[model samples]
Target: MRLNLPSVVLFALAVSLCSSPSLFGAEASADEKQADWIQLFNGKDLSGWTPKIRGHEYGENYADTFRVRDGLLVVSYDGYQPSDLMSMDKKGKKGFDKFGHLFYEDTFSHYLLRVEYRFVGEQVENGPGWAIRNNGLMLHGQDPSLMTLNQKFPVSIEVQLLGGNGKDERSTLNLCTPGTNVVLKGNLFEPHCTSSTSKTFHGDQWVTVEVEVRGSEVVRHKVGGDVVLEYSKPQLDPRDPEAKPLIVDGKILLDHGTISIQSESAPTEFRKIELLPLDDK
Candidate 1:
């Protein structure tokens, strides 16, 4: 004969067994959950970091344009005018290119980096038109000694970020190989490679950019949770004029280096700058 227990009793017994501490250890506390996150920015100060501006000394105070306001790192220019600086063009007029790069002190070889940025203020009229819609995050930055005394910018791999007009939509996460070449689809480029297409980003909105870098092979760029660009084996192409000098003595490839944020021509803001170290899984 079979013994049939009441359905309600059986259900109660099963529930009690599942909820018992013996079956599953105590639940994780709030502190345990927070351990997963690391604060890159303290939100109150700029400690554990340094800044580099164009005109000023390498480690001195940042240029007037780059500042912290309302708890956000703002690169603003309201009272400033382009006509005050020396010109880079043949016309010989002042422009924003005078201040080119603002680099961070810490460097990383392979890691996952995340940043949130937004553009502000109107575009400077009749300014350096080429750089009107500009700003970049440079990775694998080389030492300043490699550049000429008059050189204004660092030679690094730029993950070019652009806020485009509707008609000319360039991808949000594109690679602008500065002083280098990249291999894609099994072919070498002439040290100058543009993205196949651009992903359009809405203007004046905070966009999230992420990059997963691993040495000279397999670098990935993601925007808003989607993988937008990927490249492998970035090195100098001997054929290109700019790259020729870099690879002439066989010492141009970069495997690991520091990261930097560019202050090209437009006013921009970055809120979150963080990195997560990756381990070989």
Candidate 2:
């Protein structure tokens, strides 16, 4: 039997469409079954998220501190109240602490997180004491309920993402063991640890930060494609006093937990937020 050209073309198109269910609905079902790359932000609204400012209740009231503008998560100063501002250098401008927190609703463990961030607006007041403007991404963070009303922040390993003027050169991916500490090499350091070296990026340009975390075994931080910093067995403790609590209490486990973005003192923007499970294979 002979087939017409138009009929054969139509049949081939139909077969191709049928084979690739992604063009319809089967792909979505397949995604639900596997460890897939999920977008934390739907690109339209912050529907699945709850925002908290400085440990306050999570709700829409804090929405002013964090907002979505032009498809980017913008941390701006527009939402802060005058009373909440802190004075530095005798300046009347309120500091960034008035709106210090911006957390995500869901948490995860053993996943790869990728984010692109850039500084926005002019340099402003930041840092604790004189450390410079400090912003961070907290992983393995526990429930907010674990904190006291007056508690500044809970114990979590922070991927310290910083940006600042040339004074201190503090722009590196450091590890801040908030209420915890980790063993490095053979010694125990303070709850705070800096990367071997600091890596800096353009102030306004978007920079990609990627982290691969698996339980408490190892955590890796990459910047612009280079492995800028890494630590292994972060749960282990040295004899350092700072690490003693983290070790004795056994809060170092990174297994599965929530992820959060910080709103330190300066204005920042997050353009892309995504995650993939390590078990996708």
Q: Judged by TM-score, which candidate is best?
A: 1
Model 1 ranges with Cα > 4 A deviation: 1-40, 79-82, 85-94, 144-149, 191-193, 196-198, 236-249
Q: Tens digit of lDDT per residue, candidate 1, span 201-237?
A: 7568888888888877777888766777788776755
For residue 223, model 2's alpha carbon misses the true position, in angstroms, by: 1.4
Put down candidate 2 lDDT per residue, 1-281, tens digits, no spaces. 97667978999989999888677756554225435777887666665666556646655435376778888887776655454555333365434444354556787777778887877665444434433445678787656544444345545678887765644455556788765555565555564667636466645666778888877667888876677777765552344333344443545544656677776656788877888777523
Residue 84, candidate 1: how far off, in angstroms?
Answer: 3.3
Please list the Cα RMSD from the true structure of every candidate, rounded to 1 decimal place.
Answer: 6.0, 7.2
Predicted model with the maximum lDDT: 1
